[model samples]
Target: MRQDRAIRTRNLILESMASLFNEVGYDAATIAALVERTGLTRGALYFHFASKEDMARAVLDEAVTREGLSPQAFKLQEWVDLGLLLAHRLPREPILRAAIRLAVDPKARRLFGTRWPDWVALGRELLTEAKESGELLAHAEPAAVSRAFVGAWTGVQLVTEDLEEKLNLSEEIAGLYELLLPSIATPAVLAKLDLAPYRAERLLRKSCGQETPEHE
Candidate 1:
């Protein structure tokens, strides 16, 4: 119906704005430029969004919603789902990472600035779930553990991001999977992690030798 078109048009506008946001920082983005990029006149733009700030808010909500999808609506489950989702789609959608950086802008404080707290909450939830399943270190503090894991993963992605093009992602993950796999799990559960993600593992396998301490 008419409402559907409005939502769809809003989404189109948000998507155009996100593309621009990724290229330039959020403060630098402008309504006129957005209009030019989206091929929508000022009137059409206003019809869908009250103002440029409104459009930015809409874009943040859309990005968060997309990243926050956890299959079911449970908040904790959403955190874990976020992990899998990031793992599966990150190579293809580097913009998601860029979007997270933009979340911290003061002017857009409502959107990205509070994500660190969200990350803290996410860390607590995920570790709590893992503990309930009897899968964590016996004395692990959920907050500390969660923060460590999320921080490490986030930092690693930042560090290794450039490696994706120069190196093969799947093969690399497979190799790392073969190593980190054991630390996080028992032999039984660890067996289930796909080693295709760890690049070193594939290379070691090709060499037909046991994994060394470094890559392992």
Candidate 2:
């Protein structure tokens, strides 16, 4: 029972952290804000995390773990769908994007292994699955291409969010397809990995809370 309560508390902490970090960028957020948002005492917070960075790492992991895209023997198209799903999910929410940025920071580079690593891994897994369908370039490196896929999506997100200008989602999606279709998808595979829903989902995710894209 103690262990179960501990797990519950930890989950509560992670959920609280995800919402707080999703709403406010890490630098702008404070323990007071976390406490106020969670209604957890400082001692209770510490009982779960050693520091905010630790909590941020937990949040980053929670984001990936809850994404419903992690490996479970998914097919190539499914892999692509999953990879693009994450790509779409990250940029739409300012807070989640900020946490991703924080995870990649030199000061908090540990998150690279946790969050950044998985994004690319997700891409590679999908690309490899495409290979099984014999739809990818024979000379292509799935892992490298996968990283590029996720990276390109992230780059687009960063630009759009920072500029906060009217975005052309069609143009962005077209540009992304132009880049990846050349290397990662054979004409056959390209035909298979439908980009429309993935592209639409990102816009929908951004419109909703980026942290949770469930209903949207």
Candidate 3:
């Protein structure tokens, strides 16, 4: 019971820190602000996180996870869903938004490295599987394609946020896939892909009452 309470308090601290980091970038998410927002004593907050930088690193470390993604017959479709779902959820979830903000901020990134490599690795794994299954073009190299795709995806989100604070994230990502998929995917697989703005929402709805496991 005591351990449970400690875990809960730690989570509350992280949640409060995420909210501040989301609203204002890392530089502005001060330790005092976290204490005020969390209504926790300075000692208590420090007990969980030695400093604001520690909190930021924790958020960045778990920034993007592969939880809640339902498996698909096509690994390429799974990859598409991963991006679409992140777009769908980012605007609504301040924690994830905070992580993205930290990732892109030069100062914060120096303190806590960006999670781009992890994302690239995840993309490479999926693309490799798709290629092995003959879903990709003969010349599609998974490593190079995944790296480029992650770069493009990061650019797309930054642009979308600049334009409208992510009001059009799903639409923007859908357009990205539409333009890029043709070059990588085979004709049959391309035809089967659903690059809709609401694809993630539909997937969630379909996954209702179902057990969709997380990917490591």
Candidate 4:
């Protein structure tokens, strides 16, 4: 029980710090602000994180993995699932939003570095598998395509967030897939792909055993 409580407290601190960092850039998000946001004393906050940099690093660490994705018959489908899950989750998850902000900030990025390499590595791995399984076109290069995809995904999110009309990120990312897949994937595999914006939410629900009815 003590371990569980300690884990919960640590998570609370990280989540609160993430929100603070997202609202205010890394340089502006102070220890006092985090303490106020989490309703915890300085000592309590210090117990979980030695400094603000420490908290920021913790949040960035969580940004590397695809948390809600599952294996699919086509490795390219897994890759799409990963991107869609992030698109669906990033708007609602402060940790992810904060990580992206920190990664793109010149000062913060210099001090802590970004998770772009890690994401690129994961993408390359999946795309390589897809190519080996004949899902990709004969001339497609996994390394190059993966790097480009990461760049495109980041650009889409940043632009969508800045839009005056408040566009849906999931839809934008799905459209990105539609635009890019033809160049990377074979025609048959491309035709089999599900690029719907709502697919991420439905896949996540199905994974959790709370699958929504099709009629809904």
lDDT scores of the candidates, listed in order? 0.56, 0.63, 0.86, 0.90
Tens digit of per-residue lDDT, candidate 2, span 126-202: 67876776767798788887677667766775676567678754456456766667665566656655566345464
How much is 13 displaced in model 3, in angstroms? 2.2
**Over the full model, what C-alpha lDDT does candidate 3 score relative to the true structure?**
0.86
Query: Estimated TM-score per prediction?
Result: 0.66, 0.67, 0.87, 0.93
Top lDDT model: 4
Candidate 3 wrongly placed segments (more than 4 Å): 1-8, 164-166, 205-208, 211-216
Q: Across residues 25-124, which tens digit of lDDT does each residue of candidate 1 receive?
A: 6888888898899899999988878976776666545343233242332333334444544554556553454455466466566544535566667668
Residue 52 error, candidate 3, Å: 1.3
lDDT of 2: 0.63
Which of 2 and 4 is the better model by TM-score? Answer: 4
Q: How far does residue 153 in candidate 3 sit from its true spot (Å)?
A: 1.6
Q: Is candidate 3 or candidate 4 better by TM-score?
A: 4
Q: Pick the candidate with the highest TM-score.
A: 4
Reference-based TM-score, model 4 = 0.93
RMSD of 1: 10.3
Better of 2 and 3 by lDDT: 3
